[model samples]
Target: MAGTDHSVAPIARGPSIVLVEPQLGENIGMVARAMANFGLADLRLVNPRDGWPSDKARAAASRADHVIDAVRLFDTVEAAVADLTYVLATTARPRDSFKPVRGPDEAGQELRSRIEAGQAGGILFGRERFGLSNEEVGLADEIVTFPVDPAFASLNIAQAVLLMSYEWMKSGRGENSRPRFVAPEVAPASKDDLHRLFHHLEDTLDEVGYFYPPEKREVMVANLRTMLTKAGFAEPEVRTLRGVLKSIDRALGEHRS
Candidate 1:
C-alpha cells in the first residue's frame, strides 16, 4: 500500500465549481469552504441572489477565503462554461433523458482524465431552490449523481458539493478502490459513446424492417432505445453488438440466396 496524504488532497488537475442561479449566501460561503477543503480553486457564480463579495459568505468561508476571492461572477451558466470542453451537472433525481449518469467517483476519474488530456472541465451545481432547469442541464456534457437513500434524496447544496469534492479528491489520490468492481478505463465505453451505439442499432433496425406500422414506429423505437441505453454497454460490448448485427446481415443474405 502507498502512503496517502490525509490532509486536503489537491487534484493534479482540479475542476471548476460553477453555482448556477444559487439562492443563499450562507450556502455560497459554505460551498467555498467545501471547495477549499478539497483544493478546488476555480469558482464561478451565475446570477446569484445575495450578490457576490458577500460578508456572510466570507464569514462562512473562514480560512477558505482564497476560494471566495477567486470566485468569478457570470450572467449565465453557458457564459460561465463557454470555454470549458467538458461540463457535468450535479443532480439528485434521475431523469428519463438522454445523458450519462456518473457517480462522483466515476465523475472525478473522468474529470481528472480530461484535465490530464488538456481539456477544460467544469461541473455545475444548480440553485438551492429549484435545481437546474432541464434546459440548463441540457448544456452539460454529462451528469454527476450522488447515491443517497432513495426514500429521501434531497441533499443540501453545500453538502452535495462537499461530497463530490471529497470523492474527487479521493479519486485523485487513488483512494477510491473497491476490490470487486471492474475498472472502467480498460476499454470502457462512456455513456455518450454508448448513446451513439444505441442510435446506430435503431437505425439498423429501421433498415432491416424491424419496425412496422409507421404510426407505432416512434413508440417502439423509443422503447427499444431505452432498453438498450439502460443496459450500460462498454466499448467492446458495443463492438460486439455491431458484430452481431453484421452476422445477422450475412445470414439474411445467405437466406435470400
Candidate 2:
C-alpha cells in the first residue's frame, strides 16, 4: 500500500489472475493490491459473489486502480481462462486428477517462461471458504500448491495471490528479476590496494612488537592477511583502514620520541 509509485508504469501483461466465485469485494481489492505490488495488472473475476465495481474493493486496494480499472468479468471458470494458453490452479489439498503438481517457485518460473514466449497464461483461485472444487481444479493445466503446515493450510485469497505474484516477479530474467532498488555502486579495492594495506598493517604491527616469537610471526601475519582478504572491502574501506593505521603509526612514533 505504501510503496505504490504512480510515476512508474505497471506491467500490462503477465499471467491472468482468475478468481473463481470470490465471495467478498474486500478480498478482490486485496488481490488487486497484491497484483499491483508485483507489477501485475490483468485481473479476471469469475462470478464475484458481491458483484463488481465495488467501492470496498477500491478502498482495500489502496490506490491500485490500474488493476481495478481493467478488471474482466466472466460467468464461469472455463470462460474466464478460455483465451489463455496455460493455466495453473491454486489448491492446498491433493486431487484425484492426474495434473502435474508444482510448487509456487516452479510455477512462477514456468509462467514467466511461457509469457516470455508470447503465450497467454493465467492462475485460478477458488472460493475463499472451500477453495476450488475438483470440477474447478479440472479446468487448469497444472496444479500449484503452497508448502504450509498441514494442520491449518488454508490461505486467504489475497495471501495466495501475493505469494504467486512475488514468485512471478522473481522468476523474471536479468533486470526484470531484480528488486526496484539496490545498494549504491562502489569500486572494489584492487589487488594492489589490498597488498598495500597488508604491508601497511604488518609494518605497524611490527613497529608495535605485536608479533611475539619470531618463528610465529609469519603464521600470525598470514592469518591476519587471510581474515582481511575475506572481507572484500571496497576502495573507500581500504583507504579508511589505511588512514586508521597511519594514525596509529603517528601515535606510536610520538610516544617513542
Candidate 3:
C-alpha cells in the first residue's frame, strides 16, 4: 500500500469492509485510503497478520482518519460479517461456494439495492497474496469476481477496494452505467412495439412457408414469436423492420412470378 495522498473524501453510508487475514499494515492503510476515496468509512479487520494499532498503518492512511479511527477487529471472517445481512466475497477465481456471482459493478449495485431495502451488507477482502480461502468465501452470500486476465488474476488489496468502492459510489450517484448513444429523443423499445414487430414478422414468415409441416406450425410460430419478442425493438426500429420484411416479401413474390 504505497501511500496515495489524493485526499480523503469519506461518504456518509456504505457497507462494512472486512479484511480477512490481511498481511501488511501498509496494505491495510492503503485499503482504508481507497475506501475513503469513495466515501466508505466502515473498516473491519479480521486477524491482520502484523497485529493492529500500527503507526505504519496510520502513516500510510494519510488523511483517512475516519476510516482508521473507527477500525474494528475480528478473529474470523464469520465474526466480521455476522451483524450484516448480506456479505460479498471478492475473489479472482471460482470458489467452492455456488453462491450468486457478479462483477464489481453488479455487486456494487446489489449491495446498494440491498442496503436500500434495509439490509446491512459488507465486502470481504482476503489476504494480500493467496486471497480468500474457500471456507472463507463460502460464508459470503454472493461472490464478486473481477474479469482480469487468467494468467494474472491477482490484484493488490487496495486496488480491489478501490474498484468496488468506485462502483458502489457510482451506483449511488446513478453514474455507474455505460453511456447511451441513443438517437436524440428516441423513446426506447416498448412492449407494444415489440409485439407489433413479432406479429408482422410472423405474418410474413407464414406467407413464406417458414413453419414447414402443418403439425409443427403452431410450435414453430410460437418459437418464432418468442425469438422476435425477446428483441424488444424500439418503435422506429420496428417500423424499419416491417418495411424490410415487406421489401423481402415483394422481392420473393416477384422472383416467384
Candidate 4:
C-alpha cells in the first residue's frame, strides 16, 4: 500500500481520486492507470458522461484492473466525498476565489498531517472540458493549482492525478520517521465524525453571520463542510475548535453589551 489508513488496518490511505463530471471513459481509464502506477487504488466517479464500468475505460486502464473494479459512483460531488475528511481540488487555472490554495507538495504535507490526525483525506479532479466549477472548487478544503509555464499550463487529468499521488506517496515514506515498509501510526478521521464536525461548524458560522444570502446558504454550508471535512480534523481537535468558536462568540457578545 502506498498510503496507509490506520483507520482500516492493512488498508492503505491512497487518497480517493474523484473525477467530477468527467466526459470521457477513456480519460477515466487513463486516470485509473495513472493512479495504479503511483500505488493509488480508489477511484470515484461523479456523473461521468460516457458512463462508468465501461469496457472502453477498462481497456484504457490496461493493467489497472483493480482501480477500475473498485470505482465508486455518485450522482453529486457531495455524495462522492461524504466519507472523505480532507479534500484538495486540482485546477490549472486559478478561480480567483478567496480560498486557501496549495501546490502538490504543500497539499501532500497537509494531507499526511490530516491522516496522521486520524482523518480520511483525498483530492478531487475535475473534468477535461471545464475543470472544476466554482461551486465544485468551493467544496474542497484546499485548492491545488499546479505551477507550469505561463504559456502552457493545462495538464491532462491523468497527469494531474499522478503528480498529486506521487507527492503523497513520497511524503508517506519519511526516511527518518519510518522505513518505507513499516506502517505509520496515524489513523484518518471517520465519515461520521467529519459529518458531525461540519454541521457543528456550519451552525457556528451561521450564528456568526458568515453566510449572508439565505438562498445560497445550503451551498455555502456544503462547501465549508467539504473543506473542513477533507482537512480531517481529529475528534479532540474538532472539539477544541468548537470550544474556540464558543469563546469567540461569548467575547463578541460581551463587547456588544
Candidate 5:
C-alpha cells in the first residue's frame, strides 16, 4: 500500500481492498494499478494462488511500487476483514440474502459517511471464476452489484476494482470537503490551464499531420481535445505535456532535416 500523505491537511483514506482466493498474479497486479489510480492503497490478499512476492504481479503493476510493496497476505476472508467496521462484498449474481444491495455510487457515499464517523471499512472482491461464496457474502455488512447486461454480467477482477475505486474516490468531493492534493509538484488544474493545454496539443497534432483526411479533421480534433481535457491536467502536468510536444516536434524536424 502507498504511504499516507502527511501534509498540513491530512488526506482522507480509502478502504482496504481484500481479494479472496485470487487466482492470477497478473490480475492482482492490475487490481493494484486500478486501486492506485483511484487513490486506494491498502490491499489484502486471501490465499493467492501464485503466492506472495510475485515479481510477475509487480511487473504488471507498471510502477505502482507502493501498492506492490505493501501488499498484505491473509489466510481467510473472515480474518482479512476482521478489523473493518463496514465491509461491502461484491457479487455479480443475486443471492438469497436480504442485505441491502447498493450500486457503486451509493456504497461509496455510505463508505465515506462511515469513514468520516470513524469507522474503518473495506470492499471484498472474490475469485475471478467463482466470485464470493455465500458464506463470504453473509459476513459482509451489505452487497454491491453492477447494473450490467444480464446475459453477460461477468467483469474482470481489475475492472471491478476500477469501478468501485472510482466511486470511492468520487464520494469525498462534496463542496465542504477539502480537495485532495494532486502531486507535490502541481495543484489541481484550472479551466484556463486546460484550455491552453487543449490548444497546445491540437496545434502539435496538426503540425504532425495527425489530422488526416481533410473532411474528418474537425471532428477528430474535437474528439482528441475532449479526451485530453477530461484528464484535468495540473499546472506542472500541462507544462510537462507541452514539453513532450516540443520534444516530439523537435525529433520530427530532425528526422526531416
Candidate 6:
C-alpha cells in the first residue's frame, strides 16, 4: 500500500473474494489489501471468527480502506456465493472429489474469460488452520490448487489471495501486466552515429598506442566495434561517448605538445 494513489479509481469489477471462516481480523485485512492490489473488490466473509469491522484488520491493510470499507459478511458459504455464477475454491490439498482442478494461471484465465462473458465469479479461500470443508468446495464450479512443496503446502491467507489476484490481473491485462512506470524513451543511435563513434574511438586509441602489434589493429578494431554494437546505445549515450573520446584525444594532444 506504499504506492496507494487515491486519484486513480480502484478496479471494482473482478471476482469476489470469499473467505470461509477466516479466524483473524488481521488476515481479513490482509486479504482486503491483496484484493485492492490487483483491482478486485467485493470481499465476502463467511462466519469470521472474531467478528467484523476490526481495527486490527484496518491497521494491517496499510490503508487499503476501499476494500475494507466495502466488505460484505455472510453466515454461510452457500449464502456467500449465492450471487456468483462461477466460483473457484482454493485448496492446497487434493480432495477425493473429482471437481476439475486448475493451477493459478489457468484459473485466472478462466475467471477473466467468464467475467468478460458477463458472468459473475468468485474465488473461495478456506480458513487458516484447516481449509474449506468438502461441502464448501462442492459449491465451487472448479478447484484451484497452488503448486508448492507437498510437505509445506499451506500458505497464509493473504499470500494465497495475492497470488490469485496477481494471476487474475495478468490474465486480464495480457502483455500490459507491468509496473506503472517505465524508463524514459530515447531514440536509438543510428548506424551512422555508431560508425562515427567507432571512428573517433579508433582514432583516439591509435594516438594512445592502445592497439599493439600494428598487424592486429584491424582485428582489435573489429572486436571493439562488435562490443560497442552489442551495447545498443541510445543517441544520447552515443553523443556522450563521442564527447568523452574528444576530451581524451585533446588531453593526449596537449600532453604530447
Q: What is the C-alpha lDDT of each candidate?
A: 0.77, 0.85, 0.77, 0.77, 0.80, 0.84
lDDT of 3: 0.77
- Runs of candidate 4 exceeding 4 Å displacement: 1-11, 177-257
- lDDT of each residue in 187-229, candidate 6, tens digit only: 6565456667878999889888999999998668766765675
Cα deviation at 185, candidate 2, in Å, is: 40
Which lDDT tens digits does candidate 3 get at residues 45-139?
98888998877888888778788999999887756775675678899987643467899988998889768656678999888878887656655
Off by over 4 Å in 6: 175-257
Q: How well does candidate 6 score on lDDT at residue 100?
A: 80
List TM-scores for all candidates, in order: 0.65, 0.67, 0.64, 0.70, 0.64, 0.67
Candidate 4 C-alpha lDDT tens digits along 146-207: 88897988888988998988887787775535445755544445545555566677777777
- Give me the displacement of residue 150 in model 2, in angstroms: 1.0
For candidate 1, the TM-score is 0.65
Clashes of each: 0, 0, 1, 12, 1, 0
> Which stretches in model 3 have alpha-carbon errors above 4 Å?
1-9, 175-257
Give the best candidate by lDDT.
2
Can you tell me which runs of candidate 5 are displaced by over 4 Å? Answer: 1-12, 176-257
* Model 1: lowest-lDDT 10 consecutive positions: 182-191
Model 5 C-alpha lDDT per residue in residues 193-248, reported as the tens digit of each score: 55556677778888877888878986675556445644535567778888888898
State how far residue 46 of model 3 sits from its true place (Å).
0.8
Best model number under TM-score:
4
lDDT of 1 by residue, 1-95 (tens): 24434465444458889999888888899999898778788989999998877888888876577788889999987678766767788998876
Error of 6 at 139 (Å): 0.8
Runs of candidate 2 exceeding 4 Å displacement: 173-257
Give the Cα-based TM-score of candidate 6 against the true structure.
0.67
